[model samples]
Target chain A: MTGTEPTADETPTTRSIPAVAVVDAQTPGNVGTIARAMKNFGFEELLLVDPPELDPDGEAYGFAGHAREDVLPNAQEISFDELVSSYHTIGCTAVTNEGDHNHVRFPFSTPRDLAQRLPTVDADTAIVFGREGVGLTNDELARIDEICSIPASADYPVLNLGQAATITLYELREMTLSPAGTQLPDLERVRASQPLLERLYDQWDELLVEINHPEEKREKTARMIRRVFGRADPTTREVNTFLGVLRRATERPDQEE
Target chain B: MTGTEPTADETPTTRSIPAVAVVDAQTPGNVGTIARAMKNFGFEELLLVDPPELDPDGEAYGFAGHAREDVLPNAQEISFDELVSSYHTIGCTAVTNEGDHNHVRFPFSTPRDLAQRLPTVDADTAIVFGREGVGLTNDELARIDEICSIPASADYPVLNLGQAATITLYELREMTLSPAGTQLPDLERVRASQPLLERLYDQWDELLVEINHPEEKREKTARMIRRVFGRADPTTREVNTFLGVLRRATERPDQEE
Candidate 1:
């Protein structure tokens, strides 16, 4: 997932992650954006069917971002026939048939469901995306082993090619890439300790007692404070700051009668 | 969700769907793509802080697609202060702090989590995206109420602005839009009936008997067939076709010894 370079060393049969295949895309910029999205989610192999001329200085490269170096340049130009025969294909389509009578589009899996199912299949898989406007032809869809659709508003379910690919890749990231090894902070380090929380609560209770005339409502107020802290999941630093503020308030002299 | 036109009649405070705010975006095309993505996911109001000049004939309009008429043209240009003051802001960032020491970027919610949490909050909400390059500055991030990060490959976590926005909008579509009311076929209509499935299984059993298959293996074979059908979830037509094929094979004339 870390490396952007194509895994030429590993044969297609051995590859675990699905190859991203774009079929007859109209815009080179869209292709580039798809490649960029592929890289973002850690997909390496890109298969292009009937691709446009990708001039190095053209929109394809210009929009590819870092993918220009790897995914875009190393894209495999393949035929539609070759795509279906070479790998177990899942065609990504926005428009779907209404009834099961058309088996090609019916019984489609959402990208989320595919992420769970595809990993168990012991075959090289390719996720095929179609043209921006019309999407995959019925002939092409029939040939593909399965169909995957992104759930969008029925009003305008047709996501642009780049977006459809990006969302699909994002959903499949769990299967394609390992958990991010980046330097992002761990959640556990931020959670305050139980003792610290208890001390904070004790301080709050004392403050309520010192400032309040209504003894019956003090317990309810204390419970509410606890619930707020529980929901916030405040960091250790935050807890300490809160503790400090409460301590100062609790120790303060009562106002003159 | 169906309408592309802005809801001019409803006040922002009264609107349920979160407004999308872009802060200091560099490219007009990205803004256009973001607007298109907004329309795709059924989000309406768009707020821009220090946005690029979106000319009528420029890339912004060109990329806006159908959104050019509504989301793009009607985008409200406001200062960053106005953005934070008016709505409960959620900042979207790719890079995050590693430790609790820097509270600004730590403890961020993923888009999936936000979809669940944001709907419960009564306040008018805004999902604020930063520049294409640097993203939201530390100063800007500190002012935001909460942070949301998309999970990506550690190697290349930085998604382009359009893809990032598109994915975020897609995740939040559950809250923004209702379930698709389009003519897409329902799953129940296609599912083979239990009786039909049983008949198909009976034909398969008859075929195995006619072929003089080992009696011990027949039960296992039938069970395997059942499992296959269960997984395939074939259409009524598919089940009937399978039944016809099995019946023909079972009733075929036996070859002379």
Candidate 2:
């Protein structure tokens, strides 16, 4: 399933894909935490919008761990307007917050939903995480195109800055890397058609009755056979083989020995 | 959708729920970051299995944010054996790692898969995350019932300690809080049956032809109409309304006024 960890040779240049921007972020530790998450999910660019004097030497790097050199030093400090013009900005907000009534934050997509939508777009995208205190203000939210939020417990729907960033990036990375519509391997057999599957099930149902399976259980046993086959998603050839076995079992009802 | 941020009266006591255990966790900030994530996801208990001296006054609390009061103080330090005895331990690992041949890590479930399985188990559970560097050794992994790993880019599948914890806890909490099989609201309209939808599409297809919607574009236009309506998943009543509107429009032929 992991198709071998994409070597340096396989991993394409990741810059200009989707940048992560933190607007008026309060804590340096959170920024450091965000940087670590960015690296985990294969995102490189970090944008700090209108700002704070970050402890580049201290908290930011300290918390960043291995990602310090890759994400922290190169993080760009830009005004909110600068970020808006360069990329399609997606504002992040909590759905249960007071801002839910606010038009700008009303239609919030879950991170997974946003991730699914992002791969179809070829444009450079920026997922902006709001401040630590109250999140993005009305003015800041207005500048973005769409809003994305992680679905959390309604009681404490709001996630910490780092946690939100990590979850969002994780979903984005997983989705972007392996799209939901990804095709299966060519070697894997195609599933049998509906009519053939129905025939197979019919044979199994008859066999169950011939075996004197409990009258009450005949229907359920037949249904379970359908479910197991459905989950297997067997090829036409496999289905035919199974049907043959059932046909033999039905024909030789006295061959229980 | 977020039902008024469940009131304190509605909030369930979360003391003995599924806990998070950090085994020999090296960084103080990662622990703090993890605590904040735990609180974000409504998970309360924390077990530190032979962890380092955490910065109680400094980094741990500072990074914990709002979760400091709830999760940090009550965190208990216990031996690995005690953790194994107390709960159904789930080891977290990376898929791209070299432990595929190992029994515990080979058939690792994704957090989503693990979450679905957890609700069926009546026993207390503990999801154990390994150290920041090399994840749980083979010896430690063998002690757990099952392994859970986040699907990440093969190029860099290893995530930072806190980010890994945050993502895992996020999925677990989201699933535990809102199981996928939960019924939708009663107000939600039931979708139209397949035959009804097919008939509606056939009518629309004929209407498209009558309107002379660019002879070459007729098929595409009809298909697009089907796609649009298909996505809306209209109720039987709504489908009838749309069919009636289409029927009238087709019959009028020349209703320019």
Q: Which ten residues in a row have the lowest lDDT in candidate 1 chain B?
A: B180-189
User: Which is the leading candidate under TM-score?
Assistant: 1
Off by more than 4 A, model 2? A1-16, A51-56, A95-101, A175-257, B1-16, B53-56, B95-100, B175-257
TM-score of each: 0.87, 0.63
lDDT (10s digit) by residue, model 2, range A1-257 = 24434666697444346999999987887898888778767788999986567676777787786678788888999988899998899998864223223345544567788776677556788999989968888887888877776766554667778788989988888534553221212122356799999999988988888889999988878888989899666657667888888888888747677
lDDT of 2 by residue, B108-193 (tens): 56788777767654557899999988988889988886777787654456778888998998888743465332121212234679
Chain A of candidate 1 scores what in TM-score? 0.87
lDDT of each structure?
0.86, 0.76
Measured with C-alpha atoms, the lDDT of residue A86 in candidate 2 is 87
Which one is best on lDDT? Answer: 1
The 10 consecutive residues of candidate 2 chain B with the worst lDDT sum are B180-189
DockQ of model 1, rounded to 2 decimals: 0.40
Question: Chain A alone, TM-score for each of the models?
Answer: 0.87, 0.61
